[model samples]
Target: MEKPLAYRMRPRNLEEVVGQQHLVGPGKIINRMVAAKMLSSMILYGPPGTGKTSIASAIAGSTKYAFRMLNAATDTKKDLQIVAEEAKMSGTVILLLDEVHRLDKTKQDFLLPHLESGRIIMIGATTENPYITINPAIRSRTQIFEVKPLTEADILTAVDHALADKERGLGDYPVHMEENARLHLSRATNGDLRSALNGLELAVRSTPPEEDGTIHLTLEVIEECIQRKALTHDKDGDAHYDVISAFQKSIRGSDVDGALHYLGRLVEAGDLAIICRRLMVIGYEDIGLANPAAAARTVNAVLAAERLGLPEARIPLADCVVDLCLSPKSNSAYMALDAAIADIRAKGSGDVPDHLRDSHYKGAKDLGRGLEYQYPHNFDNAWVDQQYLPDKFKDAQYYQPKATGKYEVALGQQKNRIEQWRKESRQKPR
Candidate 1:
């Protein structure tokens, strides 16, 4: 059985690796390492199908080192031992460890010695943020490099190369892909070269040849194979960002029809994940306290859409979009939070008020923590205002309630009542 086109077409050397110029380009880190022949263990983190494995293999091929691949989560410590043994026999081996963030302590301990001895040059690949997911022990031992998504041009270049390569690609097949079909293949795969190549191969093999025995690949055939329709927005293009911006602004402006139009465009593009994410953000960042229930409902809708994946997911997503568009909008909550954050950033976060400091600890009383605190629950309304904010920000007011909905209107009224009470109390206070 023959391997897939994507596997066969993997870049055997750095020159053949598409995209990621920041790393593979002239004077870059990887290029510098390869040029000096002083390879270090490094982690490549990024989204799927973005040349992580290819870069690892290319490095090994360029250096003429033995290359081994393993999964950090699935492969055991025994596998690491085998690779370590191979490195001992061969002097050095480049090991591409996929999902490196999932490396258990046991396996990590075993691999550390080998990595330090320059026996196994580990190239860890993961879609996760290694800083948050990987242990410091492993992170300290290796340099980290971020792999970026391929652009449409890069995908086009890769696809064109695959079509022209006689030994590894579909060059033997008389494939005559339409220009539009080729462009759609580049734009629709969302910067995934593996997906683009797979879609291209599937279109070529599944498509019937013409009367003259030429395999004619059309846009429709490519679309069917890739399971995505070519939309006005190229997934990586400016128009895609425009559609998303329009989608959010329409909802924020309470333009139901406009929001729905943009939503349909996104749905047609088959970007359910983006739709769900944007809707949830709009729910809180736009609707907010003005229509808190609507925001809650939007969250429910997002959960439903995620649970019921696509086509069916679009139903709940549409329902949520309509609900959010019709709901009263307010940015007051986030704006106020932003104001507070700006204050903290500009004039550092002052210490917590002494009264508000923790009082349950053994030495808290001696330290005067909570000594002057007035427990609000003991007061009438359970809302006696003492000093909560640090003395430096005694006059700082971050929250400005907007009366855009019944709920916010009530909150505004309560705020006015509290301010009046505070004013009266201040007039009589020492």
Candidate 2:
């Protein structure tokens, strides 16, 4: 059986590698390793189709090392042990373990001894964050190289190479792909080369053999083959900004259905975690003291989503989203801070007013830092008029908590005390 297009087109040497100019290019670490004929156990960390596995294969192929491959998704600890035992017999062995993050802690521990002793040069590939998912001890022993997604130009070069290679690709198929169609495929694949090539192959295969024997690919054909239309919430595209704007506005407008719809769109399009985090910020910025619980709830929801990890965590996120939307709305705190910052920026830095300066340190009293500062606790009502602000803005009121929800009751009590204090203080001889 013929190999898949992505596999067939895999780079066999460093020279053939398409992307990752940072690492695999000239004067790079990997290039040095290849030239020196010295290999180190390393972890390739990144999103899918970033040439993690291909890099490993190219290293094994170009060098004299005995190469072995395994998938963490399927392989057991026993399989690793077996490979390790076999690698011990071979002078140098290169073990490529794909999806290494999927291996549980106990399973991962099995390779620790072999990796440390240099019994095998391990190359691990993982899409997940290795810091959280992999065993710390194992991770510490492995050098980590991060691979990035291919750029549009890189993908285009790859497509051109694939279309021109007669033995390995569909050169005989007279298919002329439109620029729009190519761009659509690049966007839809989300920087995954395997996905893009698979998409191209599908588009080519589905096109009927014509009289001229030429297959012309249009945007509609590419969209149809891919099935999933590029969404308005693509993380790397302009749509991301527009969708998030809509989501925030919907929540601010108290349009629950609209908010939920936008939220659904973001969640389905794999931007839930980012959305949840933004909602947490919005809770504080938009809701503020009017509903202090809104910020706390949103923060808890983000934490829950992080700990629980998807589908299950979506419930908590949804709950926070609803609570934030329904909560008593106020941006008074946001406005207050904005005004404060504007003043600070315009004025540069102001002197610390003596009464508000640090007073606990030795000799502070001689400097008049706390010379006449009143102790509110010593007064009858446990309240006293004091100069807390700077001399330049002595009566400036930045944080005016809105009278809404729980803050309403608290603000009422605070206002009564302030009025009483003012009446007594004013009656006193100046």
Candidate 3:
């Protein structure tokens, strides 16, 4: 039987690998290693189909090493032992271990000395963050490199290469692929070249030749072969941050429709906890004091979402999302805290005013703490103009409220009155 398209299209050298220019481009560390033929044990990690296995294979092919393929999930200790014995005779062996996170204690124990002895050059492949999944002892033995997701252009390059190669690809067949179909494959696989190539192969192989012996690939055929396209999201990867950022920005921009669309994607991806946390942030960071009620409702929504969970949980989330998207937006509260924090960090903290320092403890009055602290409740309007900030920041004006909506507008009036009091206090003798 013929090999799968992904296997057939696998790059035989580092130059053929399309994406991850940071690692594979000229003068890059991995590129230099492959060029020098001085290979070492390393871990290749990232989401699937980003060419972890292909990189290992390419390295073995380049150096002409005795390459062995194994899966930590399926290959047993006996399998490793056989490979180890073969390595003893071969001088050195390059073992491409797939799903290396599944490396059991037995296999790990078996390979440790071999790796240390340089008898085995292990190229471990994992989709997990190896720092979290692999044992520290085993991880310490390998250099870790992250493989990034391929862009559409990268996948397109691979697809085009597969179509033109006569030796190992479908170059012999009359493959007529539509532009839309090519774009679909390029965009829909979520940076997994294996999925794109497989989908293309399936669309070509399964479809019968036309009257003129041409196998035409259209958007419909490609979509049918690939079925539903997943949202391009890795919960731990950049896509997660990108989508969450778009969601928050949509709400802050008061784009209800856009917010809902991102919410749907998150809901589909089952990133409920991120959604919960981001929604809480949107409440305070975006809506803020402009709509305190909306922020309160969002907190309630988050609690309900945690308790209820997706499908049903989307209801409370939908309500909160609509409210937040439509609510008056402000970042004054967020900006104020950041401004205060920047001063504290860069300028260094100043002495806490004696009037403001805690003085209720035993003998606290001896330091003159709380000596002349004014009681706000004793003054009219339940307010008093005092040096609340440390003496260094006593005149600092961090909260400049925007008179945007009814809530902030009311606060703005009160703020104006407070500024008058502050001016009078600044004029008084210290």
Best by lDDT: 1
Clash number for model 2? 0
Q: Across residues 1-430, which tens digit of lDDT does each residue of candidate 3 receive?
A: 9889899987787887889889878999888987887677999999899998888877777778888999999989999999899999988899999999999999999999999998899999999999999999889999999999899889999999888888988898799987767776776676889988998889889999999999998777876787633345232235655788999999999999999999999887566767898999889998898989999999999999989977799999999999999998888978999999998998789999899889899888998989899999998778888778787887788887976668998898999988888788779998
Error of 3 at 35 (Å): 2.1
Residue 371 of model 2, lDDT score: 71
| lDDT string, candidate 1, 78-172, tens digits | 99999988887868999999999999999999999988888999999999999999999999999999998899899999999999999999999
- Per-prediction TM-score to the true structure, in the order listed: 0.69, 0.60, 0.65
Q: What is the lDDT of candidate 1?
A: 0.90
Which segments of model 1 are wrong by more than 4 Å?
232-249, 276-308, 327-430
Question: What are the Cα lDDT values of the candidates?
Answer: 0.90, 0.79, 0.86
lDDT by residue for model 2 (74-180), tens: 98888888888888777778999998877777777788778888878999999888888877787898988899988767787788888888888878789898776
- Candidate 3: list runs displaced more than 4 Å: 229-250, 257-430
TM-score of candidate 3 versus the correct structure, residues matched by position: 0.65
The better-scoring model by TM-score among 2 and 3 is 3
Candidate 1 lands at a TM-score of 0.69
